[model samples]
Target: MKIITLIRGTIRELAAKATLYVLAGISTLMLLAAALAVGADSTPDGKTITFFGKQASPPVTNEMLADLAGKLEAGFAGGLFLGIVVFGVFGTAGVIPDALEKGTVDLYLSKPIARWQLLLGKYFGSVAVIFLNIIYFIGGLWLIVGLKVGVWNGRFLLSALLLTYVFASLYSVVTFFGVLSRNMAIAIIAGILYLLLVAGPLDSRQAGLYLISENGIYRGILDGLFYIFPQIPAMESGAMHIIAGEHAEAAPYAQSFLSSGGILALSAWILHKKDF
Candidate 1:
């Protein structure tokens, strides 16, 4: 009951700030633009596609249509994956630091709830915020593309869950830094930098780095760091594969899930021991 209350309070607090409204507005605009810009006509022969009322090309064959649908879904999924990661991190980065504020922490600690419960509430609450927006954005896109373009790609909807998982993993880092630093900027920066610099570059360049480096010690260290961080690129490519209706590797997602769980546990332990 206490955790549920906290989650509700967190949602109400964030909603009051217009965060949810702003995200929803962006989603609505995207959906509206897609509806206006994308059009298709199917005749007895083939299908014709248009953008902004301008014909994209001559009528395309059924095979071409299938290829186009796969590319379209994959493109949207990739773009949304990146967009959600950036905006989601910025949106929820302040939750922990704000909660750690002097009077705020005092009020929360005064309750009979355990510290881990408090942390979990904040963590889940922030995730809930992003989860709602993700569904809105991805679901809107799915509907628009399916209804307007005559392409019903059910696998595309999986991007919503994939995007949420990525954000949750990233948020664990944000929450850990927020609790440790009690500064929103540090928390936000840490999450973004980890995504851009650490996880992204390492995952992309790991093979090349291993090939170039002769030092066994250096290679071992790189391998250790590789396993330590979330395999975002792998997860991303896996998501693309899934969106394209192909088989995706499961190891990256599994490793990322474990890494996120470990980080969250560490954050809870730190919060439990820290003096308010």
Candidate 2:
């Protein structure tokens, strides 16, 4: 019951914020507009309108439509996944620190609940908000694409689960920083920095750098960090593979699970050890 109350409170606070509303509105508009554009990808006229008016790029076939839909769905899912993580940092960054506020922490600690339960509840509650928003937004996109392209690929729906996992993993870091720093801005900034560093360069630029580096120590250091942090782009690629109806390796899922477990475990440990 205490956990439930904490979860409800976290959600209510987020609901009262304008950031969530603005993000939802923008995501909905983008997905809806993209669905409409994809619906018109191929017309009966056997021509597509370009800057120079209708031109015969080629006649669209079922195979082309399927391929295009797969690519668009993957791209759209990836965009939503990244958006969820970025906006979620802003949305839920204060949850832990707010709970840990002077009077607030006292009130919570007086309860019969264990400290770990309180922290985990708060973490899961924040994750629940992200999960709901992503599911609602991406599920709508999946339906729209199915209706528009006449390709009912159920695998695309798996992107929502993958994305929610990504957010959960990233937000665990937010929770950790929120508890450690007790400052919302610092918490949010830390999560964003991690996202920018790990999610961006770690995939392409760092991989190439590691490949060309002759220094054994340098390569080892890079490799260690590479495997330590959650490889978000790789996970996103798995989601894309599911969307494209291709066989995806299980390594990404395993990595995300391990990363999330490690982060949340560390968070719990810190919260348990820290003084209110």
Candidate 3:
């Protein structure tokens, strides 16, 4: 019950700060643009695609609509995933650091709540904020594409959950760094650098690294780091596969989930032991 109260309080605090409005405004604009830009006309023989009423080159056959729809869905899902990750990180990075401020921590600790519970509540409150925006943005996009493009791909909706999980995974790193350094800038930079540099580049260049280095120790360390960090690239690829209605591997999701769990647990432990 205390945790629930803390979660609600966090949500209310965030809402009061207009974070929800900012995110929702961006989502609404995207949906509006999609609605205005996309159009489809169907006949007995085939379908004609249009952008702003200009006919797309080479009319699409009825048989190709499914393939085209799948591609469109995947493309939109990918864009949303990227946007949410970037924006979610920037928006919520301050959550933990702000909570850990001198007076704020003192006031929070004065309550009957356990330190871990307080940290978990703040963590989940941030997640809930992102979750709601994901639903709003993804759901609005789904509706726009379904109604305008004449393709109601249900699989695209699942991307919302997958994207939320991805954010949660990355946000765990932000939370860890936030707890460690008590600096919002550090938290934000850690999440962004991990996404852009560590996760994407390292995952893609693993084979190249192995080729460049003959040292067994180097190779072993590389492989160990690969398993230690959240498997973001693999998980992202799996998300795209799922969006495209293909079989997605489970290992990436499992690896990421475990790494994120471990990181969050460590953050909570650190918070518990920290001198307020």
Candidate 4:
């Protein structure tokens, strides 16, 4: 009964702002559409506005344009802006530590709820809002691209969903980190630094120099270090294919299950033994 109430109430709160939350995606698609109308790909590279390397440069079609738009959106808009911008900045990093720092757990844990249940519930609540925003955003983009280009891209829809799920999984891991710290700024900083160590290039132009080296030994060291973090780009291959209006076979579903399951396990393991 308690779990049911928690899930229901949490979902209700998130659903209240579903439309407002989705605006990010809607705004992005509109901008892409306008860019399409005005020849967004007419740059020096000519990769976007392709003319088959022919004279007079053939007119741009929607299929070709949609393909270009989907690719850029998957990597840039979907990955960096939506995943990093909204989820990282507004959702996970903001919510978790804020809840703990403000002593919101006192109110939550008082309800005969186990600490793990409380943590899981909180994770679900925040994730719901972010999920609605991303999935619909990417799904709508695919629909728009298909209409403009006269190509069916159902696979793109699936890829977009899978990618968002992976992002959500990463956010869950970060959220648990925030909860462990119980200080908003501290948690965010920790997450940033931890991710830098886990995922950022070991060999860089700056301070991460300890991670950089041209020697085979250094390369081996870097590979060993980075193998710990889940490879997000591999999960992105399906979306890359959707840009081409075809589906590519990959292990995204299996990867998502493992990563998300790992996050849930870690969060539970930590919350179980730690004092609130």
lDDT of each: 0.82, 0.77, 0.83, 0.55
Q: Which candidate order results from sorting by lDDT in descending order?
A: 3, 1, 2, 4
For candidate 2, give the lDDT.
Answer: 0.77
After superposition, candidate 1 runs with Cα above 4 Å error: 43-45, 61-64
Model 3, TM vs. native: 0.93
Best by TM-score: 3
**In the order shown, what is each candidate's alpha-carbon RMSD?**
2.0, 3.1, 1.8, 6.1
Give the alpha carbon lDDT tens digit for every residue of 153-240 in model 3.
Answer: 7877888888888888889999999999999999999998998888886687656777888899988888788788898778877888
Q: What is the per-residue lDDT of model 1 for residues 67-131, given as tens digits with 9 covering 90 to 100?
A: 67766768877877777776777778889999989999999999898888888898888888888
The C-alpha stretches of model 3 lying farther than 4 A from their native spots are: 18-20, 61-63
Candidate 2 accuracy as TM-score: 0.87
Clashes of 3: 0
As for TM-score, the candidate ahead, 1 or 4, is 1
How many clashes in each structure?
Answer: 0, 0, 0, 1
Off by over 4 Å in 4: 1-4, 11-88, 101-103, 193-197, 202-221, 241-256
- Error at 225, model 1, angstroms: 1.3
Candidate 2 local Cα displacement, residue 149, angstroms: 1.9
Q: After superposition, how far is residue 118 of candidate 1 from its true place, in Å?
A: 1.1
